[model samples]
Target chain A: MIHRFLFHDINEGLIRHAKRYVLVVIVVVITCSMIDSMSAYFMDYFGEYWSPIEYGINEFYGRYPFVFDINSTDKFTIPFGWVLIYLFLAYMIGDYIYKDMNGYGMYMMIKSKKRWYWWISKCLWCVAVNVFYFGLLWISNIAYSWMKHGDIAFYQESDLRMSYYGFGFDNMGMPKLLLVVIVMPLLVGIVQSILQITLTLIFNSVATMTIIAGILMLSCYYGSIYIPHSYAMLIRYFSNESDPDFVAVDAGTGIAVLGIGIVAMVVMGYMIFRKKNVISNR
Target chain B: MKIELKNISKVIKKNNVLEDINYTFTGGCVYGLIGKNGCGKTMLMRLIAGLIYPTSGSVCINDKILGKDISFPDSIGILIENPEFLNDYTGFENLKLLAGLQKNVDEQEIKDTLTSVGLDYNDKRKFYKYSLGMRQRLGIAAAIMGKPEIILMDEPINAIDEDGVAIIRDLIRGLVDKNRIIIIACHDKEEMDYLADKKILMSSGKIVKEMIV
Candidate 1:
């Protein structure tokens, strides 16, 4: 029954506007490939010159007291590359799924009857699309690595060493650096889908979505800067590091956070949609 | 099988769009709801569809308040203003999706509804390419696809050509004769005259006249 519903929902949007959706996907794929290639070129040339040893040491002593140093060589490039890929795909997926105007302040589609069913189906679709996008990044990363260094195992030793030192990717037993590159941005995308759906339900406009995204970005910026030491430590402890065991523990924590964030957003979105009026804005 | 609204009022941003409206629509009759633009025809239909809430009063269908029942009256179908649709789907596909929303409706029924609305079901052309008249017919087709006992349509005749209007007139008339209650919210006097057994008029958020045509 759920599959039937999902089939209808997905085909309903895709069948009517297949050309438009296809066009969007094409644009996204091309843009992502270009950006990935450029970044790979730059990293190959400049990555070795940027080092986080000094920054990490200073922060460890509390003199340059940031929770995490953003410049660690293994710490930065791998995650940064993953994030760029995730974000590029997220933006494309969001464009395909969200019916808001093209960066304008209007939501052309309104939730009418079958509100819960539609919401759930769309949420599942977003997740599926994002996962597929993440898969693409994984594939592309392998391909790019092979192209750049003539070896698919370009970063294998670095990934293993970073995991051993307790400073690397931490999700699902993957290399800590790789996990950060992929998981963190994917989590952010999932959260964004939840947030956009909820705000659209509550306020019923694309304008509201923009405003909400702005508020959230600002809050996250400030929160990251001023978070207490205890909370920072908790985040750092859960972060991918050079130790394999710690990486495993932190990976579990990251998965838990992702699950909780998705559930919370979905529950909140469903409640708001169920109760809110389906008033026509036009 | 019956719908009743008691003292229903809707206030949005300090403007009362619907005010102190008390109305009852029993089984097996066609009602024409006539009003000027902004006079709450669409608002009242949405309220009845359980798509919107009134600030005061209650909407009861078959002795149960909307939102309290396990399902909205399995017999009620609605086409609110502007004939909103999943624009990405073909006309047939759109109707098929709506058909799944109800109970016991089959593919044949959906195909029949499309035919009755003068839509070619086998064609794979998307609804976005359809003419306004075709889109309106598709919307009506969706509303009546389940053979609902009570059908609510807002401006069912707008944007359609004369031939399209005639098709809707015949469809509504046939449904009414089958003992279904059809409420059509429209400004087209010819359509109301052809289909409505009774007519209700509104102005500035209140019912000003009720006449049996």
Candidate 2:
């Protein structure tokens, strides 16, 4: 039963979509991190210029790729790669679940015997993908740091802006930085993925995709860290652009809320899945 | 295993697929359901397999309600709509993947089941390459391989040749003495007459006639 329900489902999940997930993460994360690192080292237009090492760490981990200096006249724009990652992850998961539910409903569900088990297996697969994707992103950040500041042990940020130094990088070591940025983003990604997959089952796939995309966009536009998807964004939650002063929630609270949100989404999704008549409507 | 359906009805988008179906199927007999296209034969078989829940009533096996006591049948093999499997995998590989889920049957058993269905167990041809008849044969093999307590088949020989049809007829006919419940849906009346110990005729989501042969 375990083999059929849990292991096999996870194995198939990893084999089928994991490649696409990993390939996208690696290419985008690496390219974006490298570009941000290069700009930090080669170009210094601001009064608050730090070494490329400091810039690399700050650019990779900063919520907004937009320069944070008060004197900068450039319109603020962060790396769009982060946005694409969240959107694409939700899309892949939602598409897969909805297709399975509609296309071959009889073949898979009947063989599995337990509806909840089949759904849970899917959830497990989503979690695995999210973790691996974020883990690779963390590595890309590390690489950027290494290339910009060879053998650098300490972090330096926004020498012209005193507050920037203390906000995220003041006296912080690599270990602490990793915990705040890498681990938190992964937890948040898993949470959002869960919500997306379950909602796709409940509503139309396009509607669910659009809803998730709208929420993330609203969070970014409003500079509010309250969106569930925002929790997964290390920079947005910590140092938002629209509401930089609004730091009402910390990492601990953010993680807790997101975790609770996952439980709630799963509960609601499971209820709908159990009661819904999963026939071949397609 | 004895299967019973009490006042079962299914309405999808207001299309009454099956309405007020009441049935009691005992083991050790082969039951054939005959109906025109769009009738509820396929829906009824799905209800027995616990693939889709009824809009109104419940299905019970040995007095245990499906939705309450179990989400799906504890032990059953089904080929509902199409003879489908992973297109990339060979016939043996497909069977092996599913059989590995329960470990209920070994490699030798899967090979034997494929052979029993007149499929070459060693055939390396992928599922995508198989003709409609071969795919039907594979579906039949999957539905009956482990010999679960209950078997649900829909149009099991829709695309097979004459000899293949004869072989499947004999294979299905041989299952009556095993004390298992077999539910089959087909359009061929002669085949239904020859194989099914009981026959049911359905039209417009209702059972029109039932005869014990």
Q: Is the docking of candidate 1 incorrect, acceptable, medium or high quality?
A: acceptable
RMSD of each: 7.4, 4.6
What would the per-residue lDDT of candidate 2 be over residues B2-22, giving only the tens digit for each residue? 898899888988999998888
lDDT of 2 by residue, A202-256 (tens): 6788888898888666655444445665555455535444544656346767778
Give residue B5's lDDT in candidate 2 (0 to 100): 88
- For model 1, what is the error of residue B38's alpha carbon versus the real structure, in angstroms, after optimal superposition? 0.6
- Report lDDT (Cα) of residue B151, candidate 2: 88
TM-scores of the candidates are 0.75, 0.84
User: Local error of candidate 2 at A43, Å?
Assistant: 4.2
Error of 2 at B95 (Å): 1.9
Query: How displaced is residue A255 in candidate 1, in Å?
Result: 3.0
Question: Model 2 chain B — which ten-residue stretch has the worst lDDT?
Answer: B79-88
Over B1-213, each residue of candidate 1 has an lDDT whose tens digit, in order, gives 678899999998889999999998887789988889999888888778776778899889878887656224546677755565665678877766556555668899988989998888997987778888887788788778778777889888878888887888888888874456788888878778888989999998998899998
lDDT at A115, model 1: 51
Error of 1 at B201 (Å): 1.0
